[model samples]
Target: MPLYKTITPNSQTTVKIWKITESYQDLMAKVNLKPVALERVLGMKSELHQRGFLSVRHLLQEFGYTDSDLFYDENGKPHLKDGKHISITHSFNFSAVIVSDLIVGIDIEKQRDKIAVIANKFIDYEFDYLNKMEGDYVKKLTVIWCVKESLYKLFATPGLSFKQHCLVIPFTLLDAETVAWIDYEDKKHRYNIHFFEFEGFTCAYALV
Candidate 1:
């Protein structure tokens, strides 16, 4: 089991990351999936996605849960049957899960220059502080993207627009933490965002 790292952001919240170095068959043999999950995995056209899906089940096991203990809401957010909050993400070769007594979200994304091309789609006020000429521009963009993605997962609202509603406070790469807001429907919500990079990928999580 390549359980790469574990983080306890608070007494009630835990984050686990998995570095996927297993074959799809190997990962499949290690996890027992519910019928629906099994069918879903079998239907994935990309083997990488199948392995990512299976690796998440392995992370759930690390948190003392199983495939049967997880379900999705109408908005596609994951929930725990035991009433604990849960969020999951997987990118290329990495997968992660965050479980907390408080509402929480997590995301892992491969840092790529291509993300800058679509920055305008999900970025708004953040552009004021982002300097495209900066050496860490791509890294910073990846962090912001991860942070908003986490917020989206936690909010799970259908109309929340990342560009128009979600805003990440400015911070340097060294900060490793920042604040983000969801300004929507005449109300504002705040969340603490923490992020880190490993093996050319970024992982971030949000909590109230």
Candidate 2:
């Protein structure tokens, strides 16, 4: 069994997630791939890839879907024949997924000191606001990374720069929640974002 927990925001639409940390056998069986593309990826990176697939599979089962029920669009986004939206993530030992009627994105990261080194890469837009944070720079940094990563998935575009295109509202590190946005020209698409850090892991969600 996958050792995991789940959360569901109070939404009119059916939106939910299955967070897991266990063997991915049952979840993998659901997709029932026939030695095709995604199925073949399983062998290349068993531990990493299996966890992700299992998370999505667990989600499909909740809605009476088998592994074969899931499909990918031309942009490599996962889609369901039932018209439900899905996003998935997997770290070394944990996996998560968010599914809803509208677009959704989920991300999980193992907390590490290395983030400080790459901070400049994603911290440009945030520097203006983060510099004002008196003490908890680490916590603030973690949230910003999560927020930008979630937006990357939400946009389904990896090439977008976090500092240039993604923006997180100014909030103290200790706050459990914050709002963020992605800008395309003058039009700003907003997202509802929330994050939590526990067991040396940081998890976040973005729904638009």
Candidate 3:
């Protein structure tokens, strides 16, 4: 499949998503990968994961970049050669990348009832606005989880606890946007959060 969606959140930021319907061999033949990336993809045991990786490279190609333009730091966070901030995520059948002049992070998660089981592990302040009795409880929980995960990716700090260090302001599904803060160490940071759901998956992105 080609590009699934594209969003220009700001003048200097672009988010692109790809729906992975191509076979591993097909995707491999289409995208140009660096030697390290080639070896990494071949080492993946699951074809689904390999396909997702390749789809991300395809998304990079859409932005006129190849695998050589990207690299990972010691913390496993990705970076671009040209110094723009980039965040990548893939879940099941979808892969996405967000590139921005400002610091940014993105996450995509499959909405499942099981998330409610582990909600307490990463949720705290946001529970005040969440009512489990509502029918959209699971969906709301998924959004909160993605929001925290997005903030985590942006911070990329060691020993940061999602439940303790991150706080997502109250938000409703209809609003589609909110604010979040990271109170880590002796400093505090803020972010603008945006989210949406499609095909049983929820995507949340934070711009700082």
Q: Report the number of the highest-lDDT candidate.
A: 1
Query: Which residue pairs in model 3 clash with each other?
Result: none
Better of 2 and 3 by TM-score: 3
Quote model 3's TM-score: 0.98
lDDT string for model 1 (1-208, tens) is: 5799999989999999998999999999988899999999999999999999999999999999999999999999999999999999999999999999999989999999999999999998999999999999999999999999999999999999999999999999889999999999999999999999989998889999
**Quick one: ranking by lDDT, best first?**
1, 3, 2
- What Cα-based lDDT does every candidate model obtain? 0.95, 0.71, 0.93
Which stretches of candidate 1 lie above 4 Å from their native place?
none
For model 2, the stretches where C-alpha displacement exceeds 4 angstroms are 13-31, 131-135
Worst 10 residues of 3 by lDDT: 149-158
Q: What tens digits encode model 2's per-residue C-alpha lDDT throughout 85-194? A: 87767676666667778788778887776777789888776787765345566667877888888888768765677888888988765676788989866779999887
Q: Pairs clashing in candidate 2?
A: 30-67, 31-67
Model 2 accuracy (lDDT, Cα)? 0.71
**Which is superior by lDDT, 2 or 3?**
3
